[model samples]
Target: MIILLVLTVISIIASLYASFIYAPTELVMGDIQRIFYFHMGTVWVATVAFTTVFIASIMFLKSGKRKWDILALSSAEIGVLFITLTIITGSIWAKPIWGTWWTWDPQLTTTFILWILYIVYLILRSVAGDNVKQARFAAVFSIIAFIDLPLVYISARLKRGISPVVFGPGGGGIESKMLITMLITFLACTLLFIILLKQRILYEKIKDNLRLLKSRAI
Candidate 1:
């Protein structure tokens, strides 16, 4: 908990300073482009959370550890928070740049679908009733749902008439300073995610322990 708190504080300070001081003001978008730091940051965190959940689910299935189950749940819950923020921030940025609050663009559509899919996963967990059933069902669904992420990323690039390029590649048209700011934002958000995940897992552990103790007392 102390580590999480410390990291959270550091992340906020670093992210804000990097965005204001290190990042260059965009000429075309002006100060409004400042939102890019948050927009990209949230999305980066969401993506990492989703990936972690997917991998952790697989590990849970293989190892059958209750701790992995807790991790999976924590990650999914945090992923939802970040993804929701990503969609909202992206919409805000889009309204100014794209002139619409939303577009049926492949990227947006895929992200929206992924968000809904995870929401359903959460609902399934609520209805499953028992730990065994919930873990099995959610783990399976997480793996299947994450399969769409790559497709979503690929479709976005294909739709834009740009072949998929690995990170840090040339010809992407992103300026070096913008890229650096994005990297900084990504790092900050990643740290924030670790903090949030730890707190959530600790909370879940406490809640579960309380429930078990209550059952025993009864």
Candidate 2:
């Protein structure tokens, strides 16, 4: 854990350097484009985090394990945090270019919906508390929420909007340096996610143990 934390810190520093100093400024967007690296990083982490929640939820349903429930809850909370950051960073970048903080572009619309769905999932989890049946219902809802994840990506392509497609068909590819910087940022974000998830799971387990102790005392 210590090694991972140290490495994550170094990688984040490298990512910061790469984003601001190594990558060349975009001819069109100028310095504002630097936010793209951070935006992409957050969105990537959020995608991974939510996917973990989806898979963990499935496992929890199948095996009825507290560990899987802990994992799902941990991932969902981190996923929501990162997705919120994605929206904020995207809005910051969009303001100068699109001349607005927000618009109901297809990608944005779907992302907003995705965010709301997860928020609802979290609420369900909180309300369920220690109720096994309610928790299972929340898990089922999470599985259904997973559907929106892919839609957020495809919405940009299927319905062209203010969001620029940086990859795939109808998109302009990034320069090699910019691509490298993006990869570094992704690495940093991924490591951060892993660290946070592990800590969160550990914390949840501790809470569970304490609850068990209190119940025994009662």
Query: How do the predictions measure up, each by TM-score?
Result: 0.90, 0.99
Instruction: Enumerate clash totals for all models, in the order shown.
Output: 0, 0
What is the RMSD of candidate 1? 2.6
Q: Tens-digit lDDT track for model 2 on 2-89? A: 9999999999999999999999999999999999999999999999999999999999999999889889999999999999999999
Lowest lDDT 10-residue stretch of candidate 2: 155-164
- Native-vs-model 1 lDDT? 0.79
Model 2, CA-based lDDT: 0.96
Q: Runs in model 2 with CA error above 4 Å?
A: none
lDDT by residue (tens digit), candidate 1, 85-191: 98888788777776778877776778889999888877776676456867688889988999877766766666752122334333346667777777778877888
Q: What TM-score does prediction 1 earn?
A: 0.90
